[model samples]
Target: MIGFSDTSISKIAKRASVSAATIYIYHENNEDLLYKTYLKIKGKMSEKMFQGVDHTRTVYERFEAIIRNYVDFIQSFKDYFLFLEQIMNSPLPQKWC
Candidate 1:
């Protein structure tokens, strides 16, 4: 429900059966919405990376599981994964970089 394409606020409002003002009430601006969406995606990625771990496992096994989980998470959310890759590769604000 969160991932919207390159559409205007009015279009999104109509699709969601809400007013533009309602959307504004929830998000200060389009950038705010995008940031929130990114946070949601990042949280999901973090959760997936920590999906399975047992204290009894060997250290090597735990490391391998973590790597596999990260790969699986990236595969599951490829768009968000690509977005992250772009951010990391781009020259941006010092705070962001």
Candidate 2:
């Protein structure tokens, strides 16, 4: 979850009912954690957004499908979409990630 940047991994582990070391095994730091989470969310968003969209449709229909699916995806995963927007607009996130 892309919570505040100051959130501690230890706290995250506690909330998740996992050991701090377990979190470390998957992420070296909060940036890494956020990066991985963002990637996963983005993948899911794309997958759900494109599902059943027919490429054979005309340009206008295809554009409509894209817009409709994007709206549906954002509504279904509001938090993830917001996180992505925040990351893209802010300087806190490192591009190297």
Candidate 1 regions off by >4 Å?
1-18, 90-97
Q: What is the lDDT of candidate 1?
A: 0.74
Distance (Å) between predicted and true CA of 69, model 2? Answer: 0.8
* Candidate 2, run of 10 with poorest lDDT: 88-97
lDDT for each residue of candidate 2 in 39-85, tens digit (9 for 90 to 100): 88889888877887899999888878878989998998898899888
All candidates: CA RMSD (Å): 4.3, 2.3
Best by TM-score: 2
Worst 10 residues of 1 by lDDT: 88-97
Largest lDDT belongs to which candidate? Answer: 2
Q: What is the lDDT of candidate 2?
A: 0.83
* lDDT tens readout by residue for model 1, 1-97: 2333455688778989999999999898765665676677778888888787666899989888889999998888888898766544544323343
Runs in model 2 deviating more than 4 A are 1-3, 92-94
